[model samples]
Target: MIKFANYKKLYLIPKAQGLGLSKKLMETALSFAFEHYEQCYLETMHELKAACILYEKFGFTLLNEPLPATKAGKFNEEIVPLEDVNGETITSDEINQTESTIEDLATLKTIFKEDGTVTAGNASALSDGGSALILMSESYAKEHGYTILATVGQHAEIGCDPLYMGYAPFYAVESLLNKTGKTIQDIDLVEMTEAFSAQSIPVKKNLNIPDEKFNIYGGAIALGHPLGSTGSRLVTTLAHALKQEDKQTGIATACIGGGLGIALMIEKGVGL
Candidate 1:
């Protein structure tokens, strides 16, 4: 019998928005979850529409009312990842992870996957939320006892085919590279929103970014994307990731609806 699962606090930095790393991470996590458990549940504020959407995308449904048994309790056994529904884990060493198909959607129609490249599973959820940071001069930060995590070196925005909105990040990154006089090889981490895996996948290929160099933690697809706030979210995620991984530089980029893209280059600051 299938059981229930829960996903707790998940986030990313601003510089890494629009890259589908979140979904990738979620896939691995979910595969592991289903292998050991059954249903996976995530809780989020109603205002965080994108996250809620992501939950639904992953075969989760919203309850009209709160659970009657809300008391927390302990579990007897620890869960572990062993295999998926098919008795096979999606891993390169054993088996390839094929793109999710209509069969994956028990109820919802497959959106953007046919000719589009983005399926309901691979696309970002519509979200509502915000994130921010306090920016000040080095003198002020030092005087005020503020610890800087990263320094913004460059920013770029560009326009592209409106119909093919996913590719917008490509041009933005291209422009930022030109302006900063740095190539993609110089970047250590990237936060790209999984706005649509269809779009994000192409962006990764075009930029020639190795899978390991991008969204090592995950992207918006699984984490939930808050529209206006995602830019700041990526930056914050990147900052923390740099400190945790002891890396030097990273970039956060996103593709906006209506033919637009945004990218930011950041360098790691002092310890943390």
Candidate 2:
């Protein structure tokens, strides 16, 4: 198993379902991780249950656990205000108490059913985008011209709420820390999407993470959510920004519909 250290995540991609490409990609990623690091790492959603299952067969474990309350508090402060498509402000309190059902998210976008809590404010903003990253052995990085970004420290995934389709990040975060044998004090900031404040708010309240360490930049609510692409973008931006800021450890998280959530831990230097 290649762990993330000098070895970096070169690229993370998801092929269209039944395209016969995902399996091939997984094989390549595992081979890379095995040859480079202690364990191979990547994250995905339940929408791709098949992909998740394949990774598990290769030894990737599903992340499942709750974060410490103290960490959650610290993370919440990072959340910036969100605005609806109408440009009206969206509040977290409004999201938790929302009546938006999971079914609304299945086929609806922008328009919410009558009395829909999925109003443009409380749902994931849909958009289309893709991203990629390149990682190499630390020696290779220095030998080449790669400016080393944050190294992969640890990662986790989980299924928190199957119905509301949120609350999974908290579990994923906890699982990652547990696997890495770490705690919140070791993390500097958290990069997470505002798919809904319901999940985001619980993250802070549950983990007790300070607000400043959570969202330095605005989230999906304000910038617009990009569905399947959100996690990749979040992790990419975290790596680039952490390297630019010379920060130590940072965590990027995403909660998808159908009770799926993913978390990634990165450090200034590749870790053991």
Candidate 3:
């Protein structure tokens, strides 16, 4: 028999209420459940309306005592604003480009497949941008008196069924971890391209990546996916993110057309 636990008496201090800490806590709890249990349950008083709503938002359905196990289906909808290393929002004008603004949830319309959950509001935007990075050997950099941000580590690529191409990242990343003799726990951060909600959600679940360690910034769905430059773009962003967050290791992975996925790991430079 599957067993579930009731997480109660979980309350945030007054000062922490409005900072989205509740959602983060909930995400952390659910992530643990997803990793260890086939199903998870929680019981909360109805008086906590906001908490109830948050539970429902994470795919919990009300039941008498314990809620049934439900997978979180909402991804790509929460578009984090673009922030710099110092955590300041970067305005479009500052970059000489206009960022796409998301429409209000109520007014957003779904396109493509009939009765489809994928909508214009939730899908990745076709973007136009260029990203570049300079790579040099550690010895060469030190000899040249240049600062090193990070060092590229292992890389892995794998193929999967084209029809379920979105899942390519899971296989690719798994292979990468095995090749590097590391597990998901070793990764400090991850930059998995959000080609669509359909794929990103499942991959995240399978990998059991903690909410805090996943994309801290917005993803392709919000930042826009520049096809040709996306790989470089993800790596560039990952490198900066590692340095900014003072993290040691990170992986950048993306699903390619025709059923291929690739993952690359990078370690923060030493003494930098």
Best by lDDT: 3
Q: Cα RMSD to native, each candidate?
A: 16.2, 15.5, 17.7
Better of 1 and 3 by TM-score: 3
Which sequence of candidate numbers ranks them by lDDT, best first?
Answer: 3, 1, 2
Clash counts for all predictions: 30, 31, 0
Instruction: Write the residue-wise lDDT of candidate 2 on 163-216 in tens digits.
Output: 434557778889998998889888887888765443455466678777567665
lDDT of 2: 0.52
Better of 1 and 2 by lDDT: 1
How far in Å is the alpha carbon of 32 misplaced in model 2? 33
Tell me the spans in candidate 2 whose CA falls farther than 4 Å from its real position: 1-110, 269-272
TM-score of each: 0.59, 0.56, 0.63
lDDT of candidate 3 over 96-212, digit per residue (tens): 122322224324554443543444444555443556788888899999999887899889999975555567888999999999899999999999887555566667777988877
Candidate 3: where are CA atoms >4 Å away? Answer: 1-103
**TM-score of model 1 relative to the true fold?**
0.59
Cα deviation of 149, candidate 1, in Å: 1.1
